[model samples]
Target: MRSVLVTGASGGIGAAVAHRFAAAGDRVAVHFVSNRAGAESTLRALPAEGHALVSGDLGDPEGARQIVDAAAAELGTIDVLVCNAGVAPSEENRHVIGDVSYEEWTSTFRRMVDVNLLGSANLAWAVASRLIERGAPGAIVNIGSRGAFRGEPEHPAYAASKAGLHALGQSLAVALAPHGITVTSVAPGFVATPRQEPKLDGPAGDALRAQSPFGRVGTAEEVAAAVFWLASPEAAWCSGSILDANGASHLRS
Candidate 1:
C-alpha cells in the first residue's frame, strides 16, 4: 500500500481525502493544527490500520517541514502528499477594501498567504526532496479553491493565496516531472462542509446552491474523489492540471 500524508485532515475535505486513501488500503498520516479530537475521529474511522496523527501550525515555515518529516517518519515514506491545510475565509478575517482598516487588510493578506501558499510550498519541497533522493515516483495534490478564479470580494486574500497555490503546483509539476514525481491541484467551489453548514442552512443557501446547475453545493467526498484520482498513477499524465470541482459553477475562459 502507498503511504499518504493528508494535511488538515481533522475535518471537511481533508478528512474525506484521508478516508479515500485509507479505504484503498494505503496508510495515511492525518495532520491537524489544533483539533486532535477531530483528527482522532478521522483516524478511527479509517478502514485500515497504520494510520497516524500529526499536528503543526502551517503558518510557520519550520512547522510545515516538521509536519512532513513527522508524517514521513511515521509512515516509512510519503508516496503521496495532499496539501489540504489552509486558512479559509471567515468573518474574523474578512477585509473588504473600503470597509476594513488598512491594518486588517494587510494582516489578513499576510496570514492567508503564509498558510495557504507558503505553507503548501514548504511541504512540497520537503516531500519532493525525499522522493528525489530515493529515486521514487510520487504525486502532490493541492486543494485550491474556485474563489481563485470566481473572486472573493470580501475575502480577496483567500482568493489571491489560492491562485498562488495553483500556480505553485504547476511550477512544481514541471520541476518534479523529471524526477518521476507529478503535481496537480483541485479548485472546488461552495462545498457544504460542517463549518459551512450554517451558511447553507441560512437565507443565502438557495443562492449558493444555484451557483451550479446541479442546484446544490459540492460535497467533501466529491472533492476528495477528484484529489484521489489526480494522485493516482493513472493520472500522472495529468500533472500540472488544475481540476475544477465546481460543477460548472464558474467557468473559466
Candidate 2:
C-alpha cells in the first residue's frame, strides 16, 4: 500500500480524501492546522490502523516542511502528497477590484496564497526532493478550484490563488518528471461541504447550482474519488493534467 500525506485533514474534502486512501489500505498521514478535534474525529471514522495525525499551519513555509518531515519520518517515505488545505476570506470582506481596500486585498490575498499556493509548493518541493533523493516514483495532487478558470467577481483573491496553484501543478509536473514524480490538479466547482453550505443555501445558491449543466453542486466525496484516482498507479500517465470535477459548469458556450 502507498503512503499518503493529506494536508487540511480536519475539513470535509481533506478528511474524505484521507479516508479514501485509508480504506484502500494505504498508510495515511492526516495533517491539520487548527481542527485537532475534527482531525481526531476523522481518524475515528476511518478503519482502524495505518493512519496517524500530524498538525501544522500551512500558512507558514516552515509548517509545510515540518508536516512532511514528520510524516516521512513515521511512514519512511511519502508516496502521495495531497495539498488540500485552503481558506477563503470572510463574506463581509469579499471585494471587487474597484472596491477592494489595500488592507483587505493584501491580507486576503496573502492568507489564501500563503496556504493555497506557497504551502502546496513547499510540500511539493519537500516530497519531490525526498522522492528524487531516494529514487522513488510518487505523485502530488493539488486541490484547485473551478474558480481558477472562471471569473469570481467578489472573490478575485481566492480565484487568483487557485489559478496560481493550477499553474504551479503544471510547472511542477514538468520540473519533477525526470525524478519520476507526477504533479496534477483537481479543480472542483461548488462542493457541498459544511464550510460551503451557508453560501449554497437559499435562492442565490439555487441560482448558482442551476448554472451547472448537471444542475447540481458536487460532493466532497466525489472530489475525493478524483484525488484517489489521480494518486493511484492507474494514472501514471496523467501528470500535469487539470481534472475538472465541476459538472460542466464552466464549459464554454
Candidate 3:
C-alpha cells in the first residue's frame, strides 16, 4: 500500500481525503494543527489500520518540515502528499481594502500567504525530496480554490495564495516529472463543510447556492474524490492541470 500524508485531516475535505485513501487500502498519516480531538476521530474512522495522526503549525516553515517528517516516519514513506491545510477566509481575519487599517491588511495577507502558499511549498519540497532520494514515483495534489480564478474581494490574500498554489503545482509538475513524480491541484468552490454551515443556513445561503447552476453547494467528499483521482496512476498524464470542482459555479475561458 502506498503511504499518504494528508495535511489538515482533522475535518472537512482533508478528513474525506484521508478516508478516501484509506478506503483504497493505502496507509494514511492524518495531519492536524489545532484540532487534536478531531484528528483522532478521523484516524479512528479510517476503514483500515496503519493510519497515524500528526500535528504541527503549517504557518511555520520549520513546523511544516516537522509535519512531513513525522508523517513520513509514521507511514514508512510518504508516496502521496496532499497539501490541504489552509487558512480560510473568516470574520476574524477579514481585511477589506478601504474598511481595514494598514496593519490588518498586511497581517491578514502575511498570515494567509504563510500558511496557504508557503506551507504547501515547504511540504511539497520535503515529500518530493524523499521520493527523489528513494527513486520512488509519487504524486502531490494541492487543494486550491475557485476564488483563485474568480476573485475574493473580502479576502484577497486567500485568492492570491491559492493562485500561487496552483502555479506552484504546475511548476513542480514540470520540474518533478523527470523524476517520475506528478503534481496537480484541485480548485473547489463553496464546499459545504461543517465550518461553512452557518453561512449556508444564513441569509447568504441562497446566493451561495445560486452561484452554481446546480443550485447547491459542493460536498467535502466530492472534492476528495477529485483529489483521489488526480493522485492515481491513471491520471499521471494529467499532471500540471488544475481540476475545478465548482459544479459550474465559476468557469474559466
Candidate 4:
C-alpha cells in the first residue's frame, strides 16, 4: 500500500480525504495544526491499522519540514502528499482593496498565503526531492478553490493565494514529471462543510446554490473523491490538471 500524508487532516475536506485514503487501505499520516483532538477524531474514523496522526503548524518553513519528516519516518516513505490545509478570513475581516486597513489586510493575507501557498510549496519540495532521491514516483494533490479562477469579492488575498497554489501545482507537475512525480490540484466551489454552514443557511446561500448547475452546495466527500482520484496511480498521466468540482457554477460565467 502507498503511504499518504494529508495536511489539515483535522476537519472538513482534509478529514474526509484522510478517511477516503485510509479506507482504500493506504497508510495515512493525518497532519494537523493545533487540532490534536480533531486529528485524533479523524484517526478514529479510519481503519485500525496503517494510519497515524502528525501535528505541526505548517505556516513556518521549519514546521513544514518537521511534518514531512515525521510522516516519512512513520509511514516509511511519502508516496502521496495532500496539501489540504487552508483558511478564509471572516467577512468582518474582509474588505475591498481600497477600503481594507493596512494592518488587517497585510496580516490576513500573510496568514492565508503563508499557510496555503508557502506551506504547500514547502511540503511539495520536501516530498518531491525525497521521491527524486529515492528514484520513486509519487503524487501530490493540492486542495485549491474555484474562487481561484473566479475573483472573490472582498477577499482578494485569499483568492490570490489559492491562485498561486494552482500555479504551483502546474509548475511542480512539469518540473517533477521527468522524475515520475505527478502534481495536480482540485478546485471545489462552495463545499458544504461546517465552516460554510452559516453562509449557506441564509438567502445569500440560497442565491449561491441557485447559480450552480446542481442547484446545491457540494460536499466535502465529493471534493475528496476528486483528490483521491488525482492522487491515484491511475491518474499518473493527468498531472498538472486542475479538476474543477464546482457543480458547473463557473460555466455560467
Candidate 5:
C-alpha cells in the first residue's frame, strides 16, 4: 500500500482526504499544526492500520521540512502528498481596504502567504526530493480555493495566496513531470466542513448556498474524492490540472 501524507489533517478537507486514502487501503500520515486531539480523531477514523500522526508549523521553513521528514521516517517514505493546510479567511483575519490599519494589512498578508503558498511549496520540495532519490513515481495534490479564480474582497490576501498556490502547482507540474512525479491542484468553492457549520447555520446560510446552482455548497468528501483520484497512478496524465470543485458557483474561461 502507498504511504500518504496529508497536511492539515486535523479536520475539514484534510481529514476527509486522509479518510479517502485510508479507504483505499493506504497508510496515512495525518499532519496537523496544533490540534493533537483533532489529529487523533482523524487517525482513529482511518480504516487502515498503519496510519500516523505528525504535527508542525508549516509556516516555518524548518518546521515544514521536519513535518515531511517525520512522516517519511514513520511511514517509510510518502508516496502521495496532499498540501491542504492553509490560513483561511475568518472574522479574525478579515481586513478590507480602507477599513483596516497598516499593521493589520501587512500582518494578514504575511500570514496568509506564508502558510498557504510558501508552506505548500516547501512540503512539495521535501516530498519530491524523497521520490526522486528513490527513483519512484509519486503524486502531489494541492488544496487550492475558488477564491483564486473569483475574488475575496474582504480578504484579498487569501485570494492572492491561493492564486499563487495554483500557479505554483502548474510550474511544479512541468518540473516534476520529467521525474515521473505528478502535480495537480483542486480549487474548491464553499464547502460544508465543521469549521464552516456556523456560517451554514447562520442567516447567511441561504446566501452561501445560493452561490451554487445546486442550491447548496460543496462538501469535504467531494473534494477528498477528487484529490484521491488526482493522486492515483491512473491520473498521472492529468497532472498540472487545477480541477474546480465549486459546484458551479463561479465559472472561468
Candidate 6:
C-alpha cells in the first residue's frame, strides 16, 4: 500500500482526499494545523490500519518542516503529497480594496500568501527531497481554487496565492519529472463543506448555485476523487495539469 500525506486533513476537502487514499488501502498521515480532534476523527474514519495524525502550523517554516518530517516518520515513506492546507476568505479577513483599511488589506494578503503559497512550497521541498533520495516514483496534488482564475474581488490575495500555487506545480512538474515525481493541481469552485453550509442555505445560496450551469456548487468528495486519480501512478503523464473541478462554474479558454 502507498503511504500518503494529506495536509489540512482535519476536514473538508482535505479530509475527503485523505479518506479517498485510505479507502484505497493506503496508509495516510492526516496533517492539521490545530484541530487535533478533527484529525483524530479523520484517522478513525480511515478504512485500514497504519493511518496517523500529524499537526504543525504551515505558516511557520519550521512548523512546515516538522509537519513533513512527522509524516515521513509515521508513514515510513510517503508516496503521495496532497497540499490542501489553506485559509479561505471569511468575514473577518475580507479585504476589499476600497472597503477595507490599509492595515487589514496588507495583513490579509500577507497571511494568505504565506500559508497558501510559501507553506505549500516548503512542504513540497521536504517531500520531494525524500522521494528523490529514495529514488521512488510519487505524485503531488495541490488543492487550488477557481478563484485563482475567476478572480476574488473581496479576497484578491487568496486568488493570487492560489494562482501562484498553480504555477508552482507546473514548474515543479517539469523539474521533478526527471525523478519520476509528478506534480499537478486542482482548481475547485465553491464546495459544500460543513463550514460553507450556512452560505449555501442562506440568502446567497441561489447566486452561488447559479455560478454553474449544473445549478449546484461542487463537493469535497468530487474534488477528492479528482485528487485521488491525480495522485495515482496511472496519471503520471498528467503532470503539470491544472484540472478543473468547478462544475462549469468558471470556464477558462
lDDT of each: 0.96, 0.88, 0.96, 0.90, 0.96, 0.94
Instruction: Enumerate residue pairs that collide in model 2.
Output: none
lDDT tens digits by residue: candidate 2, 27-94: 89998898899999988888758688898888899988999999998787899999999886457759
How many residue pairs in model 5 have overlapping backbones?
A: 0
Overall local distance difference test of candidate 4: 0.90
RMSD of 6: 0.7
Model 3 per-residue lDDT tens digits across residues 140-223: 999999999999999999999999999999999999999999999999999999999999999999999999999999999999
**lDDT tens digits, residue span 1-253, model 4:** 8999999988899999998998888989999998898899999999859688899887899999999999998999999999998776577768686887788788888988999899999999999989999999999999998889888887888889999999999999999999999999998888888878888897689897987977998999999899999998899999999998999888424
Error of 6 at 57 (Å): 0.6
lDDT tens readout by residue for model 1, 5-121 = 999999999999999999999999999999999999999999969989999999999999999899988999999999999999999898998899998889999999999999999
The parts of candidate 4 lying over 4 Å away from their true place are none
Q: Against the true structure, what is each candidate's TM-score?
A: 0.99, 0.95, 0.99, 0.96, 0.99, 0.99
Show where candidate 2 strays beyond 4 Å: none
Candidate 1 lDDT (Cα, 0 to 1): 0.96
Residue-by-residue lDDT tens digits, candidate 6, 1-253: 9999999998899999999998899999999988898889988999979998899989899999999899999989889999999988898888987898899889888999999999999999999999999999999999999999989998899999999999999999999999999999999999999889999999999999999999999999999999999998889989999999999988999
